[model samples]
Target: MKIKSYFQFTNEQRRGVLSLLLLIVIIQLSYFYWSSSKSTSPSNSNKSWLAMQSVIDSLKISQSSSEGKIYPFNPNFITDYKGYQLGMSLTEINKLFEFRKQNKYVNSALEFQQVTGVSDSLLLAISPYFKFPDWVNQPKKAFSSFDKNTYENKKSIIRKDINEATQDDLIKIYGIGPALSERILKQKDVLGGFVTMEQMESIWGLSPEVIENLNKYFQVTTIPTVNKIDINNLSVKELAKFPYFNYTIAKEIVTYRSMNNGIHSIEDLTKIKGMPNEKIKIIALYLEF
Candidate 1:
């Protein structure tokens, strides 16, 4: 009877318990509905994002194809990086470099092929872009009669002392322009004058072909006298003022000089730690013991 009393509830209490059970069932149904909705929303979002990504990839492909189109460029000026982009091997590039070292140039695409020994397919592909100087492409004028003395006189008149060459003179060279001519003059001013033809290499943007032309027409007939540096006596700061040396190298040189009592010659300077062996000869030109 006591157990039966525990199982039984008052009418109001029974009503309250039924209401609580209904509230819990409603909450559970709402939770399940929202969970299923959230799951479906992500799947739809993923499908939309995938479609957008495919469109973006297609746009990138088209853009890359347009950008990858090669433009016409001078084949003679091709650097290793440029050659690599054009599918040239290291051997072909070296052959071009070797030919250029001899102060020779390939005036035509056919000549370029002969010198570099590039495959015919590569030659055909790149020849269209080979932009040689105007003089190289211009037809040679033929004279009906040849005069030996007149030809010699004209050749003599054509060549000039490089030290006295003005900007006007420099611009007359096929490859050199007003800007390059001005730069050459400016470098000449800074160094007081060029000591050697090799000094032309220091000028920025001077190509091998341009230098060859420069050599053909101009020569250092009179080398300018430079104020020589007293290498053994100068302080690190003073030594650093020399064009070939920087502060670190200057300091090392001074330290070496101190340790050895004094540096005697270019040979002594070369023995110093961190000294550039090849540059010592050039540096020797401006230094006294």
Candidate 2:
């Protein structure tokens, strides 16, 4: 049996096939024309795409701003991690660490930059946060433990424990009166107890002559109880709480401690920048290692 050929189709059937092909072609052309000449995009899709881009840009800006956040802190205490956060390079950080290791101090913005060799822009950016101790802000009369005059008086001078002295007992001293005597007691109370003869010098409104007379008679025996700071755990604020050390000295002490493993002896404290050696002996009396 032979298969029938396409020429066997009737004209009606052929016209039907052509009509079907024409209809399909027309439908595809109309679909393409409408798709290519669209009226507008859906508002939601356009808005959503734009909104996603905006969110991504906002996150990028937030990340950049976060990098600029700088908390106020004492520059002297910057550890390697803290230095890194402040945008310091390893060499700059190491230079700062080296300067501190010498038992030295950075007292100004200029000095900080000099020690660290930080960029001028970075120094300016961070300079406002540089905090030195109050003493660095306003220096006091220079003191020295090696001063020969500190021990100039005769050995025969009478001395009494500052805490044991009564108002009348204090009055017997050449320059002390009832008011002054009370002031001394109050100071002693506030300080726990006098740990050094030099502490009398801190009494308010006392003339130098009067201070000398009082010093001739008064001395420190019993140290009032105090919570000594662990040099290893010291902060500038904590070290300043001691009656013997002021804010400036406290910062120096802590900075020195950080550079070194920790303060090991009174002698170590003397090495701190501008530490009064005479006071250090008295200060040492109250502090543990």
Candidate 3:
């Protein structure tokens, strides 16, 4: 009888099992419905994200455009940030830096392009905004017209001796004026008179062209009488008074003279370390052993 009972199902137990199965089915159905309704579709989600991205992109474009507004500026003075805003490359900016380092400048838009090697289209874009100094835009003064006959007569004029040239004569050279003429005469007076044409180089303001003209017009036909200084016997202080010998060279000479019993010639002076070998010939003109 107990074995038979083990196989038998009570009505209450069967009903309980059926009720539990029904409850599980209801819960599963509710979960499926809730999941389908609560979650969004893939298409809708992508659409929403794309719309937000477009708004973000538009805002960025507007901000960049507003901030990048250009004003009138000198192209010569572009800083790194300013250059970036002007659409300049790193290479181009560095080229400008190298030009400025040499103490040179770009005076015109075309010159700026040549120095920086910017593109023509870019130059055209930026050139309208470039504001250079007033002097740069002004037309250069034209040379005055000379009468052909007068010009021919002037060219035929004979060159004169420079040694005897007066200040009025000196000013007739292309570059010389009142001030330069005065300086030349003063230097000549200091030297007791010009000896060799090479001595004209010491004149402070005479350009090579002016010197050439002076040489063309003048010759040291008569060597000036210079009172030669006794280099061996003069005190260091007195020796320093010579135009070519500064106090430092004078002291060095005195020190070497003391060590070697006295400097005898140009060779001895050359061996004194600080004596200028190249200028020895000129220095010898005013010095005596």
- Best candidate according to TM-score: 1
* All candidates in order of TM-score, best leading: 1, 3, 2
What tens digits encode model 2's per-residue C-alpha lDDT throughout 102-137? 866677889989999999998988888877643355
Candidate 1 off by > 4 Å:
1-10, 25-63, 66-85, 88-105, 131-166, 179-183, 196-283, 287-289
In candidate 3 the C-alpha lDDT for residue 9 amounts to 86
TM-score to native of every candidate shown: 0.53, 0.39, 0.46
* lDDT score, candidate 1, position 250: 91
Better of 1 and 2 by TM-score: 1
Candidate 2 residue spans exceeding 4 A from truth: 1-160, 171-174, 177-179, 202-204, 215-217, 220-227
Q: Candidate 3 residues 225-275, lDDT tens each?
A: 876888888998998887677899999988998999987888887887678
Taking the tens digit of each residue's C-alpha lDDT, what string does model 1 give over 198-256?
Answer: 77776765777779879888888877876678888899999887667789999998898
**Global lDDT of each candidate:** 0.81, 0.76, 0.81
Better of 1 and 2 by lDDT: 1
- Residue 285's C-alpha lDDT in candidate 3? 77
User: Which pairs, if any, clash in model 1?
Assistant: none
Q: For residue 264, what is the lDDT in candidate 2?
A: 91
How well does model 3 score by local distance difference test? 0.81
